[model samples]
Target: MGVKKTVFKTFKFILKNRLLFFLILLILLGALSYYYSENYYLHEEDPSSENFLLNYPDGHVVSLEGWVVDVYPGGFKLYIYHHGKDTIFDVRSNTNVSVGDNVFVKGNLDDEKIITAKKVVLKQYWMYIFLLARSALAILIVIILLLRYWKFHLENWEIVRRK
Candidate 1:
């Protein structure tokens, strides 16, 4: 009888603290997801993993996506983001690019750890900023439309469709 009473009290407390209960549930779910998530990138020694450039054999065709950290007359130095560390590689491409540009290169890996790019795609810094601005504007528009069509019911403690 005492155990049942304590369980009932605990249940009542949880029901009264809905926000705290939901927050705890969310944290538990996130922990479970992280625990079960794949960590292919974490294994840098694996040849199949894309996180390390050295995993690929020299003269092998490879495709890499990274940012240009320095630009030279012939090419630029690429900095690949791999698990909080930078994997820098030299790229030789004729495509005009600049430092801070996001680039995708498909090329052969040379013995000197250089990529002789067969094809190069560049995304300028201004284009990335414009993309962020457009995304924020779209989100703002969505929130405005949602509030216009719905309202919170204080008595019920929930959002209801406005008529």
Candidate 2:
């Protein structure tokens, strides 16, 4: 009886706050995706003309730079070309790499000669830097907005006039 009433009350409260729950869920999902994309996602990278994968055997750390020629989505396989040599790079997830985009690949080659990319960074450093700066600015703006939104609610009730 008591437990049932408490459960019903809790359910009703939750139902009344569905919008807040959904907002939290949306924020969580966005944060998770950003975390994965920034830290876990293997982005393709291209550097200078030096071959970072030269003479590297299996299980050895190989770093290479080349243009992304093809990408097989959902398979984590990317076909990159360096000096006319086709190199197979395996990413962790579906990497957004376009053809002719310069990228740097760092990983170890398995027994099958496929480069398992641990970190695939793009050659364009300035672009990523710009993006990071923009993200910081946006975060600052959100913080300011939240501060302003809550600032008006705080009150000091210490002042009083007596006759």
lDDT per residue for candidate 2 within 47-95, as digits (tens), equals: 2222343544567566666555566764245555655666666554345
Model 1 misplacement above 4 A: 1-49, 152-158
Identify the leading candidate in terms of lDDT.
Answer: 1
**Local error of candidate 2 at 53, Å?**
6.0
- Candidate 1 per-residue lDDT, tens place, 15-78, comes to 7898988988999999888865566445433232153344657786677788899988888899
lDDT of each: 0.79, 0.61
Clashes of each: 0, 7
Task: State in Å the error of residue 56, model 1.
Answer: 3.5
Candidate 1 residue 48 Cα shift, in angstroms, is: 8.4
